[model samples]
Each structure stands twice: as structure tokens, then as C-alpha cells.
Target: MAAGAPMGAGNSSRIYKGSGWKLLFPSWIIIGIFLLAPVLMMGVYSFLTKEFRGGVIWQFSLDAYDQFFFDRGLFGDEPPRLEWTYIGIFWRSIWQAGLATLACLLIGFPTAWFIATRDPKSRSTWLFLVTIPYWVNLLIRTVSMKFLIRDTGPLNEFLLSIGVIDAPLGLINTNFAVQLGLFYSYLPFMVLPIYAAVERYDFSLSEAAADLYAGRWTILRLVILPVVKPGIVAGCILVFVPSLGAFLAPDLLGGAKTFMIGSLIEEQFKGNAGNWPFGAAASMILLTIVMCVLLVYARNQNKVEAR
Candidate 1:
């Protein structure tokens, strides 16, 4: 009877293990339908010839990439020169994203540390407060930002009322406004990850370093930063990647005076130009840049793990 019972349990276990493989089919199907298909479509479209208005021909052409890298005269007959316009746009996006990431880090670290060091009973409240702003729609928040910083908006008016400035700051429709928007938009992303890491940290290690007569800066530089680095990296990636492709802050806050990569790609497909292939090519290029950033991070992680 005991031997028979053991055999029955073992058979059931094997049956469960065999069925587990089937469960992943749904997840695989979703990824294939959603993620891989769109990327493949973009890749193919990038190589195809563009049609007159909003479509692509089956024939292959590199004119999309050529247009990106080279400029001919208003008439196509002029000799091609290296193009700086799109390159400048890309550089500007990168610069703006980097600045936003830096601003998030500078403010988020201390905010996270303060929250993580609080009493356990109050930690949830702080986190809740941090997240509450996000429950509102992002578009609404962005528009509200636009209203607040406009030359005659409440912020400038308050400054004027306080007699701090003779005139309105005129913050609207400038690069500074765009940076402020990005920082406000992504601050929580930076805070939450760093908070999670800090919450898990062992404070005893800092105490030990102090007992050994290590200075506060030294302990932080050698011990705390190393331990919480993964979270910082995660926060930076979360903030930087989205900022790189963001259109809303740039378009609304920046007054659409300059084109970021997101706005440029959007214009290609949706504006009067209606260049489908060019849009696809731009998307592919952006994807490649993002992939390169991720790959570099992965390589650094691998090296750290090996060490």
C-alpha cells in the first residue's frame, strides 16, 4: 500500500510538470502579437519605397536613410552635402534627456533616503504621497504645468506679488520649461526605485564603517553608493529612455520651435509630409539607439557580476 501511494504521487507530480510548459503559450502569443510583430513591421517598412502619401511600395530603397544623412538642394539636382539638421535634433534630445535624468537623480536620492529611513508605520504614507500625483492623467498634468509657468500664470504672478522680480520670468515656451516638465513628469520613477533599494539596505554596515573612523563622505562613496547603484541605474534608465523619445513636454512647453526625435518622427507620419518610409526609418533608428544603450548597460552588469 505504501509503495503504491508513492508511485501515484510521483505520477501526479510528473503530470503537473508536463502541463506547465503549455501554460507559457499564452504569454508567448501575447508577446509575439504585440511586441515582435510591430518591430518586424517597422523594420520591413523602413526598407520599402514610400508611396505618394502615407503608404509604402513593395520595392526596396534607401532614400529614407539617404535623406537622413545627406542634403541635396531644394531641387534634387544639387550635389549632396552632409546633413546637420536631423543630427542636431537628435543631439538636442540626448542633451535634454541627460539633463532631466541628472535633475531627477539630484533631487530623488535625498527624498528617497528620507522616506526609507522613516518609521515603518509612516513609510507607506510617504510612498503614497509620492505616487498620488500620478493618478491624474499625464496630459492634464502637462497642460496644468503650461498654465502655471506662462508669463502671466500664478507662479510668475506670485513672484511679482512678493516683489521678488520686476517682471514675469517669462518661463513659458523655453528650454527651461521643457526641462522642468520632464523633471516633474519623471521624478517619481527615480524616487521609487531608489527608495526600494534604500529600504532593503542594512544600516549596520554604515555603523560599522563609522566605528572604523570612516568619514561620512567616504562611507557613502565606498559603501552606500555601491550597494544602491543598481537602483540608481534603474531609475536613470527609466527616466532617460522615455525622456529621449518624449514629445508632449517638448511640443507644448517648447512651443514647437525645435523638433526632438519624437516630434520629428510624429511629423513624418501625421503631418502634411506623410512620408511613411521616413517615419519607419526614424523609428528604427531610435530603436537602435535605445538597444545600444541597453546593451551597454547589460555588458557593464555582466562585468560587475564577473568581478
Candidate 2:
């Protein structure tokens, strides 16, 4: 404990961090083993061809990526719709996730604006309201969606009792339901980031715009949106990334009518039972997709910040 004693490794570690150059062991180890390793493996896996027994043949082949992109099989009519099916699912996942992200943006932006602009006491209350669902389990939320929208459920019952339809309408197991489910589930994600941006904003900028003869719409369009874009980016990343991999919401809400990439990859793991190589390939494909989109987003962010 002597002040003059030689500092131990722990002390040196603390000293190095306190001086602001990090040498964090756990962080590096976690990233190396968990994040980087898996991604590298996936990239490798994506390039390899599937074998007869559900394992990779360990030869470098572009066949996996080729099949993924072209969605073609080894032969024909005898052909299962792998090519167009995979492409369709890929586009659908991206499209639906985009819709969900848009919905999240529309709903979350104004709410976050309201919450961020409130008085301190009111702000806390609103934030608490916004975040209360986090305490509820995610699976529970997705499952509960069915009852609310089902034929015998409240929505259909209400509609029918009031003669809104001749019969219980086919609301469940559709793209509309999937979109609603994902949007509702990820709404909190969009709100938190936008709220953070909104709260940190300089209100006087709006006032300045007003004094400069800019109207509310112009002020919002030119001044407000540009500044809060980082938050918009963050919100999109939060909502869209997870929505891409969300199998359960689509499965439960859409009742297996629509197949998401997540569900398809999941099938390789379990449904195709022992088709490990194909399953692994599918997983890798999904991982690559999520990574590519994020990389583009990150690059765009850097370009904006640099300017």
C-alpha cells in the first residue's frame, strides 16, 4: 500500500486507462472470440459448398453465395424454388423491415418530441410510460398480439358486432399483421434514440429560425431534421436490424403464411433437421446482410460528420 512501491499490473492498467489509452482485456477478448470470430467464420462458411451429410466439404466455393443470389438449384423441374424464393424472402424481409422502420419513425418522432419538450416532472412520467413495455417480455408481447387481432379476438368481435364485416375477416397471418407486430414491438427502440437527440437539441435554433422569418415547417425541414438525423439513423438501425432477424413475430402473427429469412434459417437448424451445412449457409447469409447494411449506414454517418 506504500505510495512509493512499484505499481502492480492492475495499477498499471488503471493508470493507462486513466491516461485515456485503453488496454481493456475483457473487451478485446469478448469482441475477438464472440463477435469477430463468428463473423469471420460466417464469411468463410458462406463461401463453402454444402456436403451430402449436412456438413461443409471444407473446400472454397462461391456456390453458396451463388445459390443465395441466383436462388437456383443443382438441377431442374426437379427444381425446388430456391432461387426466386430466397430472393423474394430477402427482398420481403428488407421491405417489411423498412415499413416497420417507417412506422416506428412516424409514431416515435412526434411522441419523442413531445416527451423531450415536456417539463421535467412530465418528461419523467412520459419516459416512464414509453419504457414500461420493456419490463414486459418480448415473446409475451408478440404472442399477445394474436389475441388482439384474431377472428374470435376483440378486433374482429368488435367489427362483427357492429356489422363492419359479413364474417370474421382474415386479419391474422398476413403481411399487414406482420408489419403491425414488428412496428409495435420495436416502437420503444425508435423513441429512445430520437428522444435522446431531441432532448440535446438547441431550442434557440428554432427561435433563431423564427426570428429570421422562417416558418415552423421550414424551420423543421431545414434546421430540425438535419440535426436530429443521427438519432434517426440510430433509430433505424435499432428497429430494422432486429426486425430482419425477427422470426417469432412473423411466425406467430402471420401464422407461417409468410416466411422470413430468420424462419428459413431456423428451418435449416431444426426443420430440415440435420441439414447443418445449408442451415449454416443460410445463417451466414443473414449475418452478411445485416453487416452490409450496417456498414453502409456507418459509412454514411462518417461522411456526414466529416462534412
Candidate 3:
């Protein structure tokens, strides 16, 4: 989501005056006109039929909804394929996104925990080191992962040298690569929220739990997790929703055999079978999913706060 706008115009030469909510008007206007307005327009577009004459005619029709449901557009082959293609792609994207979310959580949680355990003075240095990679372009990172995992790359060379395997492990252009890319791209998202929560946790609480005869595992399961649940949930939202619609990573790190909702929608806009309204509809579907996930996350976070 984008930032909201600022409010009312001010006098150029006036002394500093009292502040009020009016200062937010400009930001609100920008968001209303840009982001929210576009969403409302897309919602309308999703309901209309896709016209072949380069524009949708102004008529009340459920053709788009029916085609989306039954996989038969108005201008398709004579005998329509009577199955919902877009819906199939949607479920596949959701499955891959689930895998990506699990991958991010597994890798990111440990990293955040490690960072949280560091001294206050050292935390910034460690976080900077981790966050620095994110500063580079995402496309560059995807390409870089490919280079590192290539058949003749150092990783393969080192494995062969150590006799860990007779041949290099096939780790590129597969689901494994897609998972890796997702983890790498979104790990910081998982880490920062968790780090913020964990870093501020009272170390004394664990000590108290231990004094009460609670073992380390017991303290972690009982005390630590509950306090940091909000951060974990926030991180999950950050990683899960974006990975669910991820396009670049799948295209760059994996083979064409794997295509995500993002890449598929991208194809609708830019490919030989380009269809803008259909792409808009597909995008809105993913967006709807994202909004639902966010709502659930926010509710959970609020409950945690209440506790």
C-alpha cells in the first residue's frame, strides 16, 4: 500500500500554529485518487465482458464472471474448452506460496533469533549486514542465485572436491530454486518484524521461568513464543502474500514448467495473447486474497496486543 496525502494549504509567512487532522488532506486526496480509485475501477472492470473491439461496451452483463467461472471467453475458439483455467492457476499459485511461506519462516526465524540474542551495540551491525543484500536490485539477486548454483559454480566445485557427492547436486531451475529465491527475497521481511519483537523481550522472564524449574524448551514453548507471536504473524503476512503472487523469482530461478499467478497475469498484459481486462481481473483476485490475509493478520495482532 502507498502512503496517504497531507492536508490543507498553509500561509507562507505565518508563525508555527496548532496542528490538526487537516494536515493529512493532501495525502488522503492522493491515495483516494490514485490507489483507491484504481481499485474501484478494477472492481468494475472485473464485472464487465471483455470486448474484441479494443473496448468494453457499456452494458450490464455477467459475461466476464461466467467466462472466469467456466473458462469460455466471448471471443475464443468455436468450441470452447469447458473448464475453468484461471481458477486452476489460482490454486496452483496458492500452493506454491504456501511452500514459500514455510521456507521463509524456517530460514528467517533462526536468523532473527540469533540477531535478537546479540548485544544492543552489536545488533545494528548485524542487522545492517543482513539488510545490505536487500539494497541490491531484486533481479540482480535472482540472477546471482542462478550463478551460484550453476553446474560449474563454486558450490558444485566445492562439493565435488570434498567428495560429498559423485556429481553436482541438481539445485537450479526447479521448485528448490523457487523456494530459495522466495526465501532470499523475503527473508528480511520475516526477520525485521520478528527481530523488533524479540529484541525487546525481557530476558528476565526466561530466567524467572527457569527458576521455577521450567526447562529451556518449556520456557521457549510457554513464555517466549507467546510474547513474540505478533511479530511471527506479521512476518508470515509479509512473506506469504507476496510469495503467493511472485513472478520474477519463478521466471528467473525456475523453469517454464512452473508459472505463478504473477507471471500468468503478466503474460495476459504483455504476451501474444494480451488481454488487459482479464489481466486486471486476475490481479484483482490476487489482491482480494492479499487483503483477506492482511485482515486476518491484523485481527490476530490486535488480539496479541490485548493480551
Give the number of the best model, judged by lDDT. 1
Count of backbone collisions within predicted model 3: 12
Candidate 2 vs candidate 3: which has greater TM-score?
2
Model 3 gets an lDDT of 0.81
Tell me the whole-model lDDT of each prediction, alpha carbons only.
0.90, 0.83, 0.81
As a TM-score, model 2 comes out at: 0.83
Error of 1 at 86 (Å): 0.6
Evaluated with TM-score, which candidate comes out highest? 1
Model 1 error, position 70 (Å): 0.9
Candidate 1 ranges beyond 4 A from true positions: 1-21, 256-258
The digit string of per-residue lDDT tens for model 1 on 1-307 reads 3343446454557555566668899999999999999999999999889888678899999989888889997876789999898888988999999999999999999999999999999999999999999999887898999999999899999999999999999888889999998999999999999999999999999999999999999999999999999999999999999999988888888876555888888887884568888889988988999999999999999888766
| Per-model TM-score versus the true fold | 0.91, 0.83, 0.83
Model 1 alpha-carbon miss at residue 32, Å: 1.0
